[model samples]
Each structure stands twice: as C-alpha cells, then as structure tokens.
Target: MVVRRRAAPPERCRPSPYGLRPGWDWTARAADAFGRAWHLADRYPYRGTEFDSSFVGIFRVDAADLFSAAPDLVNPAWAEATGQQLQDMVPSYDFHRLEQLPQVLVEAARESGALPAVRDGQMRTARVCGLRAWLHGYRRDQAGSLIPVDAVRWDGGVHHALSVTDDSTDAELAAAARRAEQDAAARGIKLIGASRWVEQLRAARRTAVREQLAGLRDEIAALEDRLKPARKRRTVLVTRILGWDGERDTDTALGRDAGLSHTAVRTLRTALEADQEDRGGEEGGPLAGLFR
Candidate 1:
C-alpha cells in the first residue's frame, strides 16, 4: 500500500495597509511572489550554500506588501549576507507606481502577446532591460487587455538591469562598461563568464603544489640515501670510542680523524653510555666498565 503525502498549504498573503489592488487572486499573487523570491535568491549577492538555511522564508513579503511603501524584510537571508536589513538601507520603496509606468505597460502588452514581443526575430526580454520596472509572465484577458502576472520592480536608485552600448564616445562607452561590470560585481553576478577559468586556475595551482611537494619528498629521500653511509660510519666510530681505553688526546685524535667535532664526539659517547645504563649495561657490554 502506498501512502500519499499531503501537499503543503499555500502561502498566506499579508494584508497591505494601502489595501491590495482589486481583481487580483491571492493564490496566484503568492505563487508569483514565490517565483520572484527564487529569482532574488539566484541573483542575491553573497549567497552560496551559506544562505541555504535562510531559504525557507525568503519571500516573507506578500504580493500586496511588496508594492506597499514599507521596506522591511522578514527574511534573515538578506541580513546574513549584507550584515543589515533591507529597510536599514532603503527606508521605503515606490514599487506601487511601477505598474503605472508607460514602459511597463508596453512591456506587459508585448509579454501578453497583445503586441509583438520580438522585432526581426530578436526577443524583447534581451532588448527591453535597464528599465525602472520590468513586467513579465503577462496574460491577455477576454477583453483583450494585457494583465501582468508578475513584475521585477526596483526604485530609481536601483536598476534591475544594466545595458552598455557603443553609441557613446569610446571613453564614455568604456566608462559605461566599467560601471556595468562594477554594478554586476556588487550584486555577485558573473558577467565576464570566468567561473570555469577560475576553477581551472585553482586546479592548476593545486596540481603545481602537489608536484612541488612530490619533488621535495624525492629530493629528501635522495639526500637521506646519501647520508646513510656517513651515519653508519659514525655509529661504528661511537662503538669503537665506547670500548676505547685511551687518553683524552687519543679520543680527540680519533674524533678528528672521523670528521666529528670533539664536543659532538663527547655527546655521542655520553648518549651511548646513558643507553647502556638504561639496559643495565647488559653483562659486560662496552660501557659496563665505565659505568662501574
């Protein structure tokens, strides 16, 4: 037997103090706002997997509340990313006036299929940008009037898109491009298509470090191999010195012949004596007489 899971309840709309516009369905509006929230998330600056936990209530503002004069955000994602709330920066918004804009109406008409959305097979979505308000997901009513289903709205200070053209002087055009790049960067949007290039650079650096470490390890091993005979010779000399019943001059002469400093030779003899003592000089070992 299969148990079917119940669908989640639709998001409830927060009542606007200014009152919602008539003839708009709450469910449809909420869904549209939900879609816009995802759009905002995709376009949000400083959002990575870091903001995944805050995705739950990102669209806290209802459709009616969005166009209202208030600017406060109930979602913590913006605050977590920017270190401040939206209302802290933008005290108020004039999104209500967006629907009445002439450009918005024209764009709405085009999207609703009331007018041609493209010219010469070029889509208006690409061409009709950098506007104060962008109307999208529009539909035509029985009366042939265009109704915008959703909108991406911003105030005068904020631009929803950036467009640069060569129509200006070379310096002016370059400046515009630079400004556009800066704006996109500020929003954490990649305009130059460098994500793959950046990953490749990181991979190359990692591979280079790995190879350098391997080369260093090989060099260390070779140096260690070269020192093996010298180390073995030193061990034999230490053993001979442990059994030597000679004067200080003779000890010094032996150390000098073995290329060991007098101090180093003395330290080795002391260390060997300590080791033998730890093992109780093992019944007439070389260091037994000295310990006794």
Candidate 2:
C-alpha cells in the first residue's frame, strides 16, 4: 500500500473575519495543542471565545435580523454566535448609531480596557437603539486585503442594519455582501410576531384545500367516464313517468308498470314518432325509431 502525506494548513495568526474570537491563539502552536480545543461558549459545539459568548448571551438578536443578514450562513447551532455578531449595535458611550459614533466613544472603545477591539476597532456593532443594523466584519476586497467592519445600512443617519462575516476569500466576501443587500431589501416587512406566522399558515392551508378540491373534481370526472359502459348496458325496470293510461296508449302498459300517468305514455309515443320522421328509419311501428 502507498500513502501520500497531507500538508498542514498555514498557521492562522488571525481568525476568519467574524465576531467570535478564540481564548488563545494556541498553547504551543503544535499539532498536539489540546488546550486550543477547550472553552465555555453560549451555544453548544461552543465556538468563538468567552467574550463572544457573553456578548451574544447579553443581547438577544431577533431571528429575522440573522436571517436577513446572511441566511445561508445560519445553522441551528450557529445562530447564537452569528446573531450576536450580526445584531445592530446597542446604545454605547455617546453614539445613537455606530455610523455616527462620536469620536469620544470610538476613542473610548479603542482606548478603554472594558471593550474588546479587533486590530483597530471595537469588536461589536455600533449602537443605535431601536434601529435595524447590519455588520460585515473585516472582509477582503477584489484586491485581496482586509476591509474592516462598517455598518452598510448606516446611510448617513437613521440607524438600520444587518451583519455578515466579511473575513473570507475575496469572492466569498463579495458574494456575502451581495446576498446581504438583496435579502435586506426583499425581506423588509417585519414578519416576526405570532400573528404574522399564523397568517402565513392560514394562507398555506387555504391553498392546500383549493388544490385538494380540484383533485377531487378530477377524480369524480374520471369515475364518471368509467361508468359510461355500465350505464349503456343497464336498463330501468319500471322507472316512473307522469300522465299515463294503459288502456289508451301502447306505451300505457309500460307507463302503468312504471307508475307513469296516461299523458306521459302518449308523450313518449309522440316523441318516438317524431324521432322516426327525423331519422327516416322505420315507416311506423310500436318500436319505431329505436335505433332503427
């Protein structure tokens, strides 16, 4: 048997551009660095760092925000991490919104020890209470260099946003941006509450009922087609008719047996005669015009 050894990945001095962080870079930067695998995180499969976990746990983000940010990136387990990372910045320092963060708060975050900074800036999204926000952590441009997190929806003033991972290959980061932009625009309606969900469910059920009824109508039509041959072979023994007299008309005997009135018997005979004339079948007979 022949074996081809696999080369190791490059030492990651920095993590993938994201809100989550690691407790330490590595114990010994060795393949046997077991300590790198241990940590206390918010969601299971506990990823990121203690800081990341606390931030996410403290500020519960709405599912809609995460979905609109980059739905493709969200998994059940990843929601906790992504939610914290993508959520809009809460009120902090003096800025109502991060886009408009006062120089003082920005400096405080950068200089102060309470807040964590990524390379050159705060790790969290800018604060703007009651406004939507989107953050794409450090991303790579087409030229292949890091572009730090900046609120995309912070168009000048009224805070509104969504967030996504920016640290990735140039193509992937660009793609994420495009997805975030389109998703935010398309899913603007706040479809979060129970009422909205119920409305959607009701609409779906109504559509299902309409589809089922159409299927039933098709089934009934098919059944009728199958019954055509049987109907042709069958005959009614003495089906009732109105106005018949056995003594007066030849059809009277059938009418009486069938519980029809005298007039009905006469009417049946007249109809046969007319049909015979129209078809030019038999000249005259009791059974005339009965398919000749």
Candidate 3:
C-alpha cells in the first residue's frame, strides 16, 4: 500500500500595489516627513525650501498619512533633515490639504509609476477621512513629465427619504380578516367557528379509547387460552405409563413414566394445582375441595 502525503499549509503573501513595505517606523517616518513639510510650507522663507522640507517630512510621517500635513518645526533638526529627505521623498508626497492625504498620496504613487495602476472604475469605494476630492495627476522627478491617474467620484452625503402610502380596499380587508382567522386556528387559538372543531376533537378521542379497550380484551383472551392445560394429552400419557407391562419401576413415575423431563413434569403439576385452586374459589362451596 502507498502512503499518502499531507499538503503543506499555505504561506502568507503580501498585498499587491507593493511600494515600500510599511511598518510602524515607516509610517511614523512618512507622517513626520509629511507633517514637517506642511509646517515648513508655513514657516520656511521660500516656496522651494518649504516644498523640499515637505518631502523630508514625508519620510518622518506615517505612510498612512503620507500626503497629510507636515510635522511642526518645533525641532530644527527635523526640519533640516526634511529638506534633504525631500530630495528623494518628493515623489512619495501626494499633497492632501487637510483630509484625503493618504488617498491623494496613493493616487499620486499610482500615477507617478511608483506603484502599479489598478483597473478602471476601481478604487471607487476607497475612502479617506477629511478628503474632499481625488487628485487626477502628479509631477515626478521634476522632469515636467506628468502622469495622469483616474479621479474617484465622491458622494459622501446625499440622502433620498422614502414615505409610506396606505391603499386598502374592501375586498383586501375581507381577505385579510379570513387570513387572520386561519392563522389563529394554526396557532391553537380559538377561531370564530371553533365549537364544531371542539366537538370533532372530543369524538376522535372517544374513538381512540374504545379501540384501545378492544385491543386489551383480545390480548387477555389470548393469554387465557395459552394458560389452559392439554387434558387429553395428559390423560393419555398417564394411562399409558401406568398400564405399561415393563418391569422397570421408573415407568410408574410421573415424569419418566410419561416420557418427559422432571422439570416439565413439575411445571405441569404446578399449573394444574393453580387451576384447581382457582376453580375451588369460583365454586364457593365445600364440594370444590373434592375437585382440588
């Protein structure tokens, strides 16, 4: 016989759209970098310095907030590092005003060729808190080479309320009433015409009790017939044994003489004695003693 081998467990795989594998550090770095960029934009003397600072801040910020605001410039070292980090991290920063930071960044990365483009009409269900709109394109490598990505339709809040209308007719009302009656009967509740039903149930119960009594009487009769002794067989066997001419004294014995085992002879004698006692009680007289 050949032994079967069990299959190995499936290995876990990373999700697609694989840019950089993000962890706590990467996210913190991205958030810090992006936050720093936002702050730099606010405090930096020049627009170029502010923009550059944002990229470096991206490295410090969480990847989830990659397009979010830059960290505050409370620490000069972080701001200085952001300026340098922005040189390369610029492609990673997708500008999100107050909301939609990560969503914008994801769209930007997809457009800039940093991440693969998804299928059309996809990302329709993607959402980022505080995001107002989607970014359609982004600039990469400062080469004036623009990459175009799809825009997502945002419908965060448009409600259509429905009102109920009532339209009941006489026929409909009659039908509903009939259905209610049937339902009540099915649930064991009294219906309008329940008296006839109660009478039928009582009749069925009486019929069942009568049938049970008849069956019991038949069984008792069968038991009584089985208990009756075979008088002709007993008499013939006893007469034959007592009349035998054999010299063996065993022929005269109750069981051996009758060609039956001792146990069978004792059982037959007990049954006969019980029957004689029953007859004596039924006779209700001293003459019954003779029969016993």
Residue-wise C-alpha lDDT for candidate 3, range 229-290, written one tens digit per residue: 55445644553443453445342266665566666655554544464456545564332333
TM-score of each model, paired residue for residue: 0.27, 0.27, 0.17
RMSD values, in order shown: 19.7, 20.3, 28.6
Against the reference, the lDDT scores of all candidates come to 0.40, 0.36, 0.36
Relative to the unseen true structure, what is the Cα RMSD of model 1?
19.7
In model 1, what are the clashing residue pairs, if there are any? none
Ranking by lDDT: 1, 3, 2
State which candidate, 1 or 3, has the greater TM-score: 1
**Weakest 10 consecutive residues, lDDT, candidate 1?**
130-139
Q: What is the Cα-based lDDT of residue 147 in candidate 1?
A: 23
After superposition, the stretches of candidate 2 with alpha carbons farther than 4 Å from their true spots are 1-191, 234-270, 277-292
For model 3, the stretches where C-alpha displacement exceeds 4 angstroms are 1-192, 230-292
After TM-score superposition, what is the CA distance of residue 290 in candidate 2 from its true location, in Å? Answer: 6.8
